[model samples]
Target: MKISARSVAATLRDPGAWRIVLLHGEDAGLIRERATQAAQVITPDLDDPFRVAILGRDAHDRMVEECTALSLVGGRRVVWVREGRDGLTGLVKECLATRTDTLLIIEAPGLESRSKLRALLEKAKDCAVIACYPEEGRALEASIRQMLSEQGVQIDPDALSWFAERASPDRAATRAEVEKLFLFAGQGGRLTHEDVQACIGDAASVSLEDAAFAAMVGDRTGADLAIERAMNTDRMNPIGAARALLSHIHRLRRVRLAMDAGQGRAEAMSALWPQVFFKRTEAFGRAVAIWSADALMQAAVWTQQLELACKQTGSPDIVLCKRHVARLAAQARIMARQR
Candidate 1:
């Protein structure tokens, strides 16, 4: 069975129907949170050695043993596995073939559609797969409202929207911001748009956001400084910075394609999320014209390759990332002049 982010809580309310639960997605923080929730739902005391077992992908033998073991305390048993990957395929198959009632919760990175492990987990009648895609727009709005409401804090509609738009894609970041607001609101006091800007709109994230925009618009010096501030001041990871740029390139690709198909500049710009801040609207319009859909697509591919190289080779990440940013900006400048 497939469970979405919106349904994770409800599904866990009655998790017994499935023998194994797979929470995998791009949002690593959300994946970890959901896995913890599932594990807690199965075994109330997650730290109880007799009732719960936590294992890594390399501990296949231990995981298999724990999955089939009976609880020493005669209650519920949970086998929680972290970093699920191709290596756990055999152990997962063996465990699922058995009739053990021990609840298994696996947390893995985003799996490809053809991934053997994902295929096995999804095909199993006893498994539940939860895909943790990044939350945005209405889903994000709902999450913010639900969390704040539960804390007995009410927020202005405009304030809620502003907060959601600025919150990091990571669920942990979003939760932290909301919790901060809850403490700030105190008692029955309501939060306003200004409160969100003053309290939760992160300057570091804004710097990174600006850096990405700067890179896309061919502002070499501005991009360099923004990247520097984001890394040194904000402490953003190089990999994360690359991913951010890739996401922007993707949005640019889509909007450029739409404009090529005759969509107006306003129409193309209006289609994006967190809608481009008013201050950056003009720069954004220039960016859309700076790169064609094909160029943006190539940039996306190159960004992904750079990310992989950084991860696999243990290279000096910031240096390589900065070089890539500079190249992208130069390319955009050339493209802009050609137009």
Candidate 2:
């Protein structure tokens, strides 16, 4: 049977029916959260250590063997396979075919309509497949409201928009941000927009947004600071940070080109295809005002050079990143002056 992540509470109420549970999504954090919750239903005392067997994609055959064997300790056994996408599908299908007292929890990346793993579990009699997509717009706003309401904290409408704008594009990160806000508000107080601004930090949303904005506006200092902060504070992997910077530069280039073609700010933003955030529109507008088509094209070239330096240079990642960000920021400042 197919289930949505939101229906997990209902599904867990009657856990005896589902022997095999497949939780899949692009968001690693949400997939893990649901998997953990579902596992707890089977192995109520997850801290028992012996009852929970955590496996990864490489341990496919061992996972099958362990699941097939009856638990020596005799309480319910939960086998959680994390990132089990590489080659574990066949084994999971086999385990599902033969019902056992053991509960199998498989967590994989997002699945399409014709996905083999999704189809296998959806068609199976004793299996349940749960799809957890990133929450956006009204769905995301409602989720934030519900989380706050449950914590006995009331949030103003503007505060909600601030939270939404600052939240990451994934549900788990959004929940974490809301929880942080809840704690900041002392559990029972009303959360205002000012409170959000004071406590929410820059979030990954603003870090990426600001970095992109700084690059477009030729504000090297701001860009460098954003990148350095993201690398050190957020612990963003070096390769991933490089990729995000490149992608942002490319996006700003596209926006600038569209603006040159007489597109309005909103139209240029739409062309950039930014994620759900008010600052994305703001950034698009800023990019339009500050960057010429030629400058954006030049920024793209700089992004490629930075990517190569980070990957090929033997220097420490932090130093390499700092140098690149500083250079980008300086270029941005020069561009702004030229205009």
All candidates' TM-scores?
A: 0.64, 0.60
Worst ten in a row by lDDT for model 2: 271-280
- What TM-score would you give candidate 1 relative to the actual structure? 0.64
Instruction: Report, for every candidate in turn, its global Cα lDDT versus the true structure.
Output: 0.83, 0.72
Using lDDT as the measure, the top candidate is: 1
Once model 2 is optimally superposed onto the true structure by TM-score, how far is the C-alpha of residue 271 displaced, in angstroms?
7.3
Q: Which portions of model 1 miss their true places by more than 4 Å?
A: 4-7, 204-339
Cα lDDT of candidate 2 equals 0.72
State residue 143's C-alpha deviation in candidate 1, in Å.
1.6
Summarize candidate 1's per-residue lDDT along 1-339 as a digit string, tens digits.
676656778887878778999888888888887778777777778889999898876685687789889998897798988888877889888898887999998888767767788888877777899888788897889988988998999998778766887778998888888889988988777999878778876666667778888888999999988888877854577888888889878878778998999999889888887666666778888899899888888899899988987796668898888888888889988998899
